[model samples]
Target: MQTQDRTNVSSVEAAIAASQNYLLSIQYPDGYWWVELESNVTMMAEVVLLHKVWGTDKTRPLHKAETYLRREQRSHGGWELFYGDGGNLSTSVEAYMALKLLGVPETDRAMKNARDFILERGGISKTRIFTKFHLALIGCYSWRGIPSIPPWIMLLPESFPFTIYEMSSWARSSTVPLLIVFDRKPVFITDPAITLDELYAEGAGNVKFELPRSSDWTDLFVILDDAFKLAENLNLVPFRQEGLKAAEKWVLERQEETGDWGGIIPAMLNSLLGLRCLDYDVADPIVERGLQALDRFAIETEDTYRMQPCVSPVWDTALVMRSLVDSGMTPNHPALVRGGEWLLDKQILDYGDWAVKNKQGKPGAWAFEFVNRFYPDVDDSAVVVMALNGVQLPNEKLKQAAIARTVAWIATMQCQGGGWAAFDLNNNADWLNLLPYADLKAMIDPNTADVTARVLEMLGSGNLSIDNHSLSRALDYLKNEQEPEGCWFGRWGVNYIYGTSGVLAALSLVAPQSHGNNIDRGAAWLVSCQNPDGGWGETCFSYDNPALKGQGNSTASQTAWAIIGLIAAGEGTGKFEKDAIDRGINYLLATQQSDGTWDEAYFTGTGFPGHFYLKYHLYQQHFPLTALGRYQAIFSK
Candidate 1:
């Protein structure tokens, strides 16, 4: 990370001043920083059902949630996953129902518009498997239409090809608890009279409501689901009782003392409902902790309340800390020191699920959320370790030891093809994506350029060059993965602009002389992608169509990514290539808000590519400062 030298330009200096101050003012007293992890209204919608299942809807403020849902409703009368996304079927259905549960009459204008959007899109039948799960539980949709995952899968050994361990951490955590629910198939009617009878395209009875079918692979899963349902109906399974016991044991053991299971809303909600199906009282200490953990995910305002898909204190703190350092904050400044200490305390000394497949690892990594010790993310761990390097911690010995452990763990966790996945080793089972139950199509975790390059960047920051075995192999993986257009595909981020920039930075930092050609090609691709407004942007649609890569209205975060990419590609120097860099810097200067912030509403972060997206509110603020600061470090006189 390069600290900026004070620049001659007044606007540049003033912009840095505003951003630094704005960041400092928001740090928590306990020394971490967090911003909202905003997804679509579906998170808010699911929380309404959570309240009803807990039987707390009458006590909790559904009206506040109503305000947030209405606020995000597009003029099309449907809610979207991100800004300017035409609309989505499942998201719209969830939002419409949540409002109705809040007492908004079906004939109300907002409800009418939402209902039209749902019916026009083929109604409840076409919604996703997970969405169908919610509707079925409330007695609106049929349990028969949903796909099944029999609990006996829990009994499969790790040696089995299709064991649960083959799935990603998020998928397994969600599926395990749901297995118990699948076995019991419990349906609780909070209000028996209210059903989604109005939203189905054909009348509820008239619609055949077939199980999901897409391909030959899906056909195989459909057959399995039907066979499982038949055996369940006959009570003929050999290990039925033992499978339930194993699943219950798994869910109970994974819960944190804080009530969080798997550090995601779906996992936590499923676990609670699964426990309820087994007849655990709401007053049980386990259920109480689960409720409290979810409550922690909710953000309330004067007139609004909404739930985050997950909390991001660990992820947010690492990014902000790193960007602040790169933007010229002192290494030992109080804020940085406190944040570094807080982060150090978060390192997992105990192994989680990742250890099941990884024997070379002891737990010395970090998770995305505060209490998710069971599932550490490779992306978050890399960023956090990098951020720690920039801070001048007082206990230098402790810091160095933790860094060494993290480095060793990261090195051994590389996948077979010289790439790295997010949470597990060698989880590139693409065949799983075709299952009828994989409607989200995000069941598997595969290696991509963004995560591989980020791993390289972390290794580089530790001063390990191409000489290291991991770096050499990963370089090959990244090179093979680059698109013909010179941009790499970004799996964790929006599209090519993000992947191109990240790879360029990693290449320049780690293997500049050896990989200079690759960096140059990527920089040129990023330059050609610049918008007329002197910034760059790529829509989420780019994931669906490669031709749309790096194409969209410019956003502050994407522009900063472009600017930083140019700098890291050795183009920020004023000897040449100043126009593009200067124009990019100027865009940041001109758009700077008076209060030392940048405002962006577009979603740049990816959850599952086209299926789910995130708008990191702080992306606009910190990324621009990091870009301008780097430009000043090189070009300022």
Candidate 2:
């Protein structure tokens, strides 16, 4: 080998060794990776609201959460949906209300600033539906002014244009109990000083719920909401008691073994409050179990406590397993075996909400959370399959069975558009997004380029030919979805880099011959976006404005993603690509801490485009490890 090749190999080997040791050191004895899932101050504030409504004496925790919120407050005087984001109306409104309820006086300067920020953003009335619901619990906002989300919607037939099942699993879990809350209209017992009248742009009495413009389907939902309100006022609703009972039953049935509903905070909290409204005593087993489950989501430090949006053991463990294997770990390595066994235990054999839209598919996917059987996402399933496929276990039959089932299930989940969605199939009822209760913008689970690419990658890893019908359709979908600038939209990650990287990587593996020019275009786009510092980063702002794609401070995870994408596109064979990969690898090496992990404070995970984001603390470590390992395997030859 040339001296330059020898040096590159040595550098790659050293980086991989250090990163592998770090990853292994952090692995749990049971062989799963559970990283900190961080979101915004909204989680802490919502926890405060949860305790206040449940009448729990969580004084100390509430105080700590209040402190955390204050500490996180941006210099602009309001909280944001994600770290480093500008002040958000809903998050700011909720934080202000939570602090006030915790006895922070309105006269306090911080409180005054927050209040000013709220008013400047059109005040409390302009907050999202969930925020409005929380405010109404404390009597700060009139429940009537919020969009109607009657529990009666649950009684709609499956054939109906809109039903609970038509919503995304997270939305379904949250909305079921929320509908019950809407019915009971429970008020928070608090001192009069806790009211938010002072934060209102206009007097509280002037607040009104107005219909949306009649230019689109949102207007129809708005009209339906008004009609529901009229029905509610006249007590002319049909089967009201039966609807409540059915909603309650649905919530109870979906309660996870871990006591969480779908293993998400919004559903867990909503289910608890809904049960309380149904007159279930605080000591009731269901309520007690629910509270206990929620307690697990709390991440407490010496002086602060914050709530995670959700746990991600299944997702994290699977990705780590793949990274370890890619970094040269053997298939029968103990860590791989243990991790593979743990993942096999997590597969969902029973059907879930995804089955509602895709009845033809069998039950064999995995959920993102530890016990959210009702919502096994396609992204998690694909990655898990990839991880399991890399491991050689003692029980060969069990491993093969798991892989076959997962592959078949993923195939069944293909959308009509020749792609795949995260949770459900054929769930792209765009008109449903106009519903008054769809303020979170997650009502529909539509096919996305990132997820479809991941599915294609999984199929390729399993040795499915590009000529297969499913693979062929997926290729078509990706080709049609590629943007004018040679990128794709990342639905679950940050932005164009994520989407383009994912698509390029999958095409390189599954449809190399067909996607040669496509890969070239994607590779060129990635190279063009490289930052001056030799690393790549895309901001959360890209979700709102495509112009910001691939434009931000360099981050270890995004840089690694760009590197992996480029390598997959055969850029490693070119001088420019080789330099880019070396620089990106060097960036990872230089940024490594004494403990061997890379530091990443930026949010890369997306909860909702532009509205919510997440920071998976492990992404910085595992992704770079995977990228470096792949680099070594490709070019170290």
On TM-score, the candidate that comes out on top is 1
Q: How far is candidate 1 from the true structure (C-alpha RMSD, Å)?
A: 2.6
Model 1 spans > 4 angstroms off: 1-8, 215-217, 465-467, 571-576
Q: lDDT values of the candidates? A: 0.85, 0.84
251-350: candidate 2 lDDT, tens digit per residue: 9998877788988898888888889789898788888888888889998888788899999999999999899899899999998898999999989999
Top lDDT: which candidate number?
1
Q: Model 1 over residues 1-637: C-alpha lDDT tens digits?
A: 2343233366787888899999999999989999898899988888798778778777677789999999889888899988899899999999987887777888899989999998999999889988889888778887888777777888999888888888888899988888888777777877423678999898777876568666655587788878877887898876878888999999999999899999988898889889888999888999989988888999988999999998889988998998889888999999999999999999988889888889888889999988888998888989998999999999989998888888778877899888888999888888888777887888988777888888888877767433467778898888888888888888887879888988887887777877777887788888888888898899999988888989998889999998888888874221234678788888888888889998877999999987999888888988898897887777775
Q: Which residue pairs collide in model 2, if any? A: none
Residue-pair clashes per candidate = 0, 0
Worst 10 residues of 2 by lDDT: 571-580
lDDT of residue 99 for candidate 2? 84
